[model samples]
Target: MDKQTILDVLNNLEVVDQQGGDEAWMLVDVTPEMIEELDHVGVEKETVLKYGDDESVCILALAFGEKYANFWHKGQLVNWPQEAVDLIEEMESALRS
Candidate 1:
């Protein structure tokens, strides 16, 4: 998705991280479907949710990480992998609501 599309998907959230980045930030609790979707991208273990625009590290959008690293679900962050990226269209749907 394009930048604006991503913003819209995020409910037009303007949250920033500690570094004041424009991307929305949140700690998410993973669902079973999230794990399954992530698995399709070969993410079997825990990983980091590096922003697609983080230049200090390899930007996800520059690679396939964008598809797998997108996290938008809001939860208690329980029953989920730590320091991992979550990619599931279901997440976006949950967030939109």
Candidate 2:
């Protein structure tokens, strides 16, 4: 989806910290500028996992230490599986509908 479409999807989401873990659900508000940044970086919204609430701008799962390095080495971020991204996108699509 395009930037505007992603923004619309994000606006309708709700942030929640499932399991009360360190994971945070951030529904980062996407501005035109933010969209430009993501586009510049070649990171698609569908590639990211949604975290917290609709009011949040972006959700991030963080892991610190050697494990983090290992995760990065494996092309994953904070243990976020590829399936999670797919799930988030599906939920976002449903929310929009």
Candidate 3:
């Protein structure tokens, strides 16, 4: 999938919950199907799994207001996974540019 196509999928994501302290920030439960789509778009399973627990994980996107995206395991961010950071940096640089 192309970048726009990937974004189209994100655009269609249903809001699962609001993030704490930021009323405009919301969580989207990234389903297995969604992960497949992301994988098709070049986000590897390893990258996705970096944020996952034994059960599942979230692909944290800004529900509304500001447009942002991040991955989180539980409510805290994990730094041990280099692939996750690389991906995040790529996306962040894209946004910055």
Candidate 4:
């Protein structure tokens, strides 16, 4: 997806858990609607639908979320390319601007 769209998604991410820390929070499971929206905004259809008919395609998008991408990959939830990670990092940096 484009920078703004990714940023928008990150900005409005749904909270799932407290992550057992005072300030750590994890994003909620990504719903089909979220997948559809991301797909509409440039995320590949195959990428979003890869989870089959799963009701929630989970993602972690808070700070340090990039490093956790590997976990998603291991779970077969995502296969993020370096380019995608770069885009996400860029979007994350933009938060400081």
Candidate 5:
């Protein structure tokens, strides 16, 4: 995926939930389709796939104001592709405006 494609995905992200209270966090599930797109852009496929066999394997939780992006897999924090992370952070920043 090129930069625009990645950005598009981020823009159209399917928000799963928003934590309540002072620190409202945005959550988006990381689907297999996302992985496929990222794979085209050099994201590691095998690593994400090995975690599960479903359409989605992880959740991308972002604290937009805090500039934090975390990948949650099976309730644990997991390292995601840096390119994807950078794209997500950019998207979050844009959303804040």
Candidate 6:
């Protein structure tokens, strides 16, 4: 996916529980290399929900247990590296999920 496509996905994502007092947030940049990692961990785009941002890059809002993580990437989701995908999956499973 290109930068615009990734931004669209992130912008359109739905937040399950934004009220969670202690939630972690992460903004991840997806790339082609990351696809393998996502596939390995079985993470789908539906699992993610995006929010508003004030930057040129894609913004990923992840909230978990009083911790909010934001990831800013200049590249597109389709070009994300495997390491990036793995990190996202790990965070979702261990923290968010």
Candidate with the greatest lDDT versus the true structure? 3
Writing each residue's lDDT as its tens digit, candidate 1 over 1-97 gives 2433332323322223323146523422344544354444454424323432211222223122544334434521112243443445456568999
Alpha-carbon TM-score of each model against the true structure: 0.25, 0.29, 0.41, 0.40, 0.35, 0.24
| Residue 14, model 2: Cα distance from true site in angstroms | 17
Q: Rate the local accuracy (lDDT) of all candidates.
A: 0.35, 0.39, 0.52, 0.48, 0.48, 0.38
**Which sections of candidate 4 miss by over 4 Å?**
18-25, 45-58, 61-97
Give every collision pair in model 4.
Answer: none
* Model 5 bad stretches (over 4 Å): 19-22, 42-97
Question: Lowest summed-lDDT stretch of 10 residues in model 6?
Answer: 62-71
Instruction: Give the 10-residue window scoring lowest on summed lDDT in candidate 5.
Output: 60-69
Alpha carbon deviation, residue 51, candidate 4 (Å): 9.5
Candidate 1: misplaced stretches above 4 Å? 1-24, 48-97
For residues 10-88, could you state the per-residue lDDT of candidate 3 as single tens digits?
A: 5565656655644334455657886787678666667655555434544443211112333443443333356876887
* Candidate maximizing TM-score: 3
The TM-score ranking, best first, is: 3, 4, 5, 2, 1, 6
Q: Whole-model lDDT, candidate 3?
A: 0.52
Error of 3 at 44 (Å): 1.8
Report the error of model 6 at residue 14, Å. 23
Task: Enumerate clash totals for all models, in the order shown.
Answer: 2, 15, 0, 0, 0, 29
Cα lDDT tens digits for candidate 6, 1-97: 2344444444444433322224534344444434344334443333332332322112334221112223333422233456886797687789865
In TM-score terms, candidate 6 sits at: 0.24
